[model samples]
Target: MARGLGATVRRFPAGDLAALEAMLTEAPPGVSKMICMDGVNSMTGNTPNLVAFAALAREHGALLYVDDAHGFGVIGERSATEASPYGHRGNSIVAHAGETYDGIVLVGGFSKAYSSLLAFLAVPTWLKDHLKVAAAPYLFSGPSPIASLATVLSGFDVNAARGDAIRADLHAKTAKVLATTTALRLATPNTSGLPIIELPLANPDDIDGVGHFLFDAGIYVTLAAYPLVPRSEVGFRVQITAANGDDEIDELCTTLRALAERFELQRHAELPAQGRRIGSATPDAEVRLSA
Candidate 1:
């Protein structure tokens, strides 16, 4: 979007608050100091501090645009401190923070947790009319199918009704995968936020090798490298869903364990105590590749 819109882009290495603050300070005068960020980072699986981001963005006279794609229906709940019990879902970013800031613009898709195809953007009522006319897709694209609309609505109902249950089950599976392999270090934030698991391999070829091996074992995982992530970071990502049961979880764990044991997977040297970045690394360690 920025490219087509002819906007100059400035990027930070990570979403650390300090990094963001520096970027904000360096932004040129008279330019809209808009900060676009993922509520739950796709690669890190860590939820950003929405309240703090909102506060800082306000200080800089900027709009904070949040992509809550991973958070929409899977995380968040009514805060115990809040008085009202009803009408607050997606407390992770939008529903809660939007109340405090008119500058917050939230956009998310139904694909991740809601299991649908379309997406939506929630902004202050004042901007809605402007965006409807300004945003090209909303103006040009054909209308969404009624069936897809119905599916998402029904899915939203279920998501709200049983989201906590689904989140609990997903976390359990993630824990199982983490515990099953001692040699493997998770690349995502160590939290119950999302069910994404990333394994950093020492060799780029090992990523392809592991992905193919998992496919052959009746399991599927994503292999990412280079542009998807830093070139130094090459590995596969696992998206755990509540749809899988004990048998499936066990099979996945067992297969991952086999890969670690059979190929002698090396734990990356630069892992933090929590294993967040697992550090950008080239998987250079030798492993068994022969069939």
Candidate 2:
């Protein structure tokens, strides 16, 4: 969108808050800035520290734009007596990190958690009023399908009824997969323990063979091949959800063990801790894009 608008974008390396601060400090006068980042990264399944980012945005007079596509209905506000580490209510990472929309613009969709075809933007009232006229999607896109709308409405009901239980189930299933990674001594960039887990291959050239192996094992995964990702980071991603069965998880773990045995996998101890810093930009690593 920034490219479409012909805006000059400056990207900072992921989790480099000091570098971001330097950029903000060195910006030319009269140039509007928007600090865009992810809420919960889709690849590594880690979350940025919204509190710190929000503070920086507020200080710099920039709008903090967050894409929480994978976080909505999964993680939310923390509480003393919450049901699980995922927190209470599926509001999104904005609430999960105990931040507000003061200098923040959160955009997320129902596609991941609710499996619906709707998206949303949580902006200030002034921006909301302006966007009603200036937003391209609002002015140009056709109305959403009736079926999708119905699903969203029903989803709200389901969420209100037993969302916590569903999240708990998801957490348990994800924990099982994480345990498999631990036991196999395979290194993954997943620290938040969210459903999405990426296992980088020791040999990036083996991605095709790995995909084939998983496919033949009756398992499907998102392959991050070279060009799409750097050679060193090429691998596959696994997502565990409440809908997945125990038998399926067992098969996945067994297949992962076999995969480790057949093909060399990156050991957790050998690799340094991945993305330990707060407010990292990339979902997977310290990447800088010019868009």
Candidate 3:
């Protein structure tokens, strides 16, 4: 879209905030910048620093846009009295990080946690008005199916009633997997412990065999193939939910341990608790931005 509009675009690696800061600081005055990024990464289950991102965007007079697809209905506002580390309310990463939506536009969907085909955008009134009229999808697409809408409504009720308990259950199940990985000396890019665990293979060529093995073991996982992801990140992803049975989780852990023993798993030192982060903006005519 930026290219279509003839704007200068610069791509940056995930969690490279320093680079974005330099770009924004060095840009000429009067450039209208919009910073865009993910709240919770789907691959790593890691979250960027939204508080810093929002502050940086506000300081630089840029619009901050966040796609929190993996975060919505999962993580939310943090508090001392919260039930678990996943936080409360399932309002998305913005709330989880204790950040305001003043200069931020948060987009998320119900497809993951809510299991519905619905999406939302939390934006300011001005942008809301602008998008309602200018956004092509809103103009051209039909309304969401009634079934989907109904699920969302009932999902909200269920969330309000026992959402924290559900999140706690989810967190525990995910912890089981993380603990198993740690104990087996297996490397995973899942520092957040937010359910999406990517266990990369020591040998990328073993992906097909690993997929077959897991399928035969009655465990389904998302396979990250070579062309889809770099060879280094080629592996499988495991997702845990509240509805998952304890026995199912046990079977998954057992299968994972078997897989680790059968195939040489990647070996790496335990990563620190924190994850990387970045956010920025684009100017008007120049419109420089990064992913």
Candidate 4:
């Protein structure tokens, strides 16, 4: 029988393989269950690595599980990418892997891209029989609620038809925001939609002060500091969506620049030397004697 054990691990950002290699080396022999979040869902935006990792797990005799909540309706050919214009391949890492992972398990929720309160799970045929017989939830729940099921199924159909168009619009809007920020010489990393603009500050108090200033200016952005990131890294997180227009993007950038200037955020100056007078009759020899 299989070991019937599992481990959940996060993939790296920009598809770094060093961490994943280390994880596999450290895992106990005969370990079977492995779970991962599909691209752009976590800190990592890479999806190709997930496919590669899934293949590696299979070779090591482990069952691979993926929660493609963020990828399912947002990536691939039909996603925000320039290549795929239809919604068929949007955010679907497993789908992109083709028939190689025919028996993989996938989980997705509708709360994010669809903005609905529904969840779903897809089990491959090999495990379907086992899930029907051995799965505790399936055994106890009897059947899924009719209303919720209908809503979820309906959402699937709707997304299938229009997902591509929505993703394209989102990408376009995000590009506009990036261009505007770049023109202003702001520190903005190229990302899918979650853009964290680093503020030039040396302390957490400054981050709070900046956040408050933006809020008062009628622009709301998340203030991220230590624990969420690190003490050395502080920034305002901006969530971009298709609904925001070009004008809105421009306004946000303008407001941010104005607020930064108002706070004198960039005007840091070196303090005067201790025990030194700006204008005094004391001779240079007297000042040198202190040393």
Top candidate on lDDT is 2
lDDT tens string, model 2, 134-199? 988899999999999999999999988999889888888888888788778788877777899899
- lDDT, candidates in the order shown: 0.65, 0.83, 0.82, 0.54
- TM-score per candidate, in order? 0.81, 0.91, 0.91, 0.67
Ten-residue segment with the worst summed lDDT in candidate 4? Answer: 282-291
Model 3 Cα RMSD, Å? Answer: 6.1
Error of 2 at 261 (Å): 0.4
Q: Look at candidate 3 and tell me the lDDT of residue 264.
A: 72
Per-residue lDDT of model 3, residues 1-291, tens digit only: 877877777765767778888888987799878888888888888787677778888999989989999999999887778777888989998887777789899999999999999999999999999999989889999999999999999999999999999998898898888778878877776667688988888889999999999999999999999999998778999989898899999999999989988887686565433222111111001111101
The superposed Cα distance between candidate 4 and the true structure at residue 234, in angstroms, equals 3.6
lDDT per residue (tens digit) for residues 1-291 in model 1: 886688878876545668889888988887877788887667656556677778888888888889989877655544554222211354455553333646888888888877778888888786789878887888998998898799998987875686556666666676677665433553343333346766666666666677778899988887886677665567777788889988999998888877776554446344333232111121111111111
Candidate 4 Cα outliers beyond 4 Å, as residue runs? 1-16, 42-48, 78-91, 96-103, 131-154, 188-202, 259-291
lDDT of 4 by residue, 103-171 (tens): 467777666666666666777786888888987777987565677678767867866787666766766
lDDT value for candidate 2? 0.83
Off by over 4 Å in 3: 270-291
Could you tally the backbone clashes for each prediction?
Answer: 3, 1, 10, 4
Clashing pairs in 1: 202-283, 202-284, 203-283
Pairs with steric clashes in candidate 2: 15-280
